[model samples]
Target: MATRRFPTREELRVWRDFIETGELVRSAMAARLQKDGLSPGDYTVLLALSEAPGERLRSSELATAVGWERSRLSHHLGRMEKRGLIRREECLTDNRGAEAVLAPAGRAIFQQVNRPHLRDIREIFVDALTPAQLEAAGEIMAALREHLTRE
Candidate 1:
């Protein structure tokens, strides 16, 4: 029988802290977003669209930008469309492709919600970390993302 090597105590501690902190932060942010009638996923999609050129992006590009599957993005986009938050139109560049655009109402809602969202983020995350720690955290997250995205 082969024996498996266990993680070191420090490695376990790091994992635990990472997971716990992530859960807490996500929950906190979700609660605040819910109060504004938006879910995290909704905000993510809106933010991505708002940042795109002319506030529009190809459906596939939007999915990749928001790290969601096409089906999931499609479902969410349907809901958003019903809420007048976004519109889906045929892509001008590709006859078969669709595009997502942020609607005026969506832009207004995002503008209204941004201040509170930023304050909450600052209170729950940025304010809690030193500048150096914040920089390090950003680097660590980027590195992890790069590593995980490798084929």
Candidate 2:
């Protein structure tokens, strides 16, 4: 039987800090968004759609962009449609595919949420880091993302 090597104390400390910071940031952002009547998931979908050309994207493309599964995206889209925040349309390029478009209400809500959200992000995360630290964080995140995506 092979024995697994244990992580060193420094490795453990770094991993713990990384996970704790992520949780803290995520929770804080979720709270701020929820106060504005939006969930983190809703914000993610809206942001992705708002960034896409024509403020729309094919369902599969949206799922990829949001890092969500197809079924989860479909379910969320249905709820957003009911709330009149978004609408799904038949894709012109693919007969079997659909597109998710941000409705005016969704766009308005996102715009309304932006200022306060940005402030909260700055207060809770951004302002704590120097420019160099922010750059390093971005690079670290990119590397981590690439490693995870490779799996």
Model 2 local distance difference test score: 0.93
lDDT of 1 by residue, 1-151 (tens): 5665997799899999999989999999999999989999989998999899999999999999988999999999999999999999998888999999999999998988888998999999999999999999999999999999984
Report the lDDT of model 2 for residue 82. Answer: 96
lDDT of 2 by residue, 32-137 (tens): 8999889989998999999999999999999999989999999999999999889999999889999999999999999999888889889988899999999999
State the C-alpha lDDT per candidate: 0.93, 0.93
Root-mean-square deviation per candidate:
3.1, 3.0
Candidate 2: Cα lDDT at 10: 95
Using Cα atoms with residue i matched to residue i, what is each candidate's TM-score against the true structure?
0.84, 0.85
